[model samples]
Target: MESEQAERFTATLEDKLQSLLTKASTLQPEEMLIRHNGLLYPALLCPEDNLRQFAKFDARPEDMCIASYPKCGFNWVNQLFRDIAAAVRKDDGQRKIILLEFSGADTHQVINSYPSPRVYGTHCHYENLPASVIEKKTKVLVVFRNPKDNAVSYYHFCQKHPLLPNSASWDEFFKEYMAGEVAWGSYFDSALIWEKHIDDEHVMIITYEELKENLIGGVQKIAEFYGFSLSVEQIENIARKGTFQAMSDNSQETHSIFGNFFFRKGVVGDWRNLFTEEQSREMDAKFEECLAGTKLGAKLKYDLYCKT
Candidate 1:
């Protein structure tokens, strides 16, 4: 009797999986870029899955790169940078922040269409990026969050995204994510790769927790790093507008303003709501084992429950 029950459960699981895949296959191709190992890959549903390659990085003195593991405060940092740039320039109109993606539709072409002093967002792992970006001394601002939080956020992101394969449960998603089978591979590995170059003059590592703890100070440091001096009034203005409450309230503003809702939730400790105690421990073990000797282990102190 027990054997029969087990077999039935397995069959039911398989049927559910098939149903989910059918739903995913029917989703129309959204305009957002697909990412792989940090490099943006072409849309999965595109006619040909031809991954877009990055052009030679023609980094000018004013070029800036905002790099992050997905859902690790990437959009928030980009918005903050845009606000600061605008404050420094004293312009209030809708400013075009040229986001350069390695894959998907030609964002480079759009960036080229615009003028100088561009702010570009990318998730391309350090080794995969264009050589010019490194050699030409372009400014790089890397933001990383706790891996546990990142995993939870990524799971939620995939659930809402028609482009990704949706998991029936958090357990199923965690299995693929730990094995690096999911898009962009392991978040812990991605952070370690960038952490190696963190001390370079052109690269600065910013933790999402640190940024959340001190928003105004964080923005000031970023401005100073980029050699942009701002007045007290300007700093206050940028900080006020960049708050999570403020950004979330503004529907017009998001990571995918024209497409999907990229800025879903800006809060931390969201993993607790979704992760079981056993699953949380499993994730912590994975983090400890995988990131044992890496620089990121030192930089990002993971609190699975965000207690500390």
Candidate 2:
């Protein structure tokens, strides 16, 4: 009896999913929409489908790419770059920042619209990026956060986005994350791939914890990496403008273009609030088992709380 009931439940779920897909397929490209921070965005679509004609998309040597796993410090860094570029070009009468999102339906259009010396943001794994971008040797700034905190933030983000019914529970979400079933693939794998190219002088890796600990220093490092130098006053100004309080207050409708606030409690150890001792240990063991021989194993300290 239980087996029959389970089978029926599974079939019902599959039917509902197919119905949703059919409805989505019926919509025109312009009619399909994505929501960000309570606002309807018409540009959200599948990256693979949108990027199919990838050759038309190109990058210049002056282009900048800010890459990070979701729920990391992408937006915070974006805001920081905006401030730095704005400050640098204050008297030059130039718009120093360009917003490029990888998953948007009009992403290619937006990227192609910008001139040289543009800044693009993406969550694409290294192998999946456009060939032109790699060939141009665009400056890449990659940031990473502790996976525990990333998972917690991602859980809440999924709750708002409603991508999967299974993500309603933390355990289900963690299972998908651990098994590398989520979009953008495994966090460890993505980081390691980028790490291999970091020595290229065009790529730099920044950690979220370090950014929080020293905002001014972080901004200065970013400026230096991009072949620009900011005075002490300018560094201070950028740091002040990029604060969580400032970002939270200034964000038009939301703290970020993404659904979640960019300044969502920009503090380390936030994972402690979400994971119990046993859960943390279990996650750490999983990380160790999966990434045993990888460079990411050394790059990330899964036991962040214990280390401190």
Query: Of the candidates shown, which would achieve the greatest lDDT relative to the real structure?
Result: 1
Candidate 2: clashing pairs of residues: 43-105
Give residue 66's error in model 2 in angstroms.
Answer: 0.2
What local lDDT score does residue 195 receive in model 1, on the 0 to 100 scale? Answer: 69
Return the clash pairs for model 1, or none. Answer: none
Candidate 1 residue-wise lDDT, 135-209, digit = tens: 788888998898778888888888776656668888888887777756666676787788678778888888888
Question: What residue runs in model 1 are displaced by over 4 Å at the alpha carbon?
Answer: 1-51, 55-57, 102-106, 253-260, 292-295, 303-308
Q: What's the distance in Å from true for residue 138, model 2?
A: 0.7
What Cα-based lDDT does every candidate model obtain?
Answer: 0.68, 0.64
Error of model 2, residue 221, in angstroms: 0.5
Q: How many residue pairs clash in each candidate?
A: 0, 1
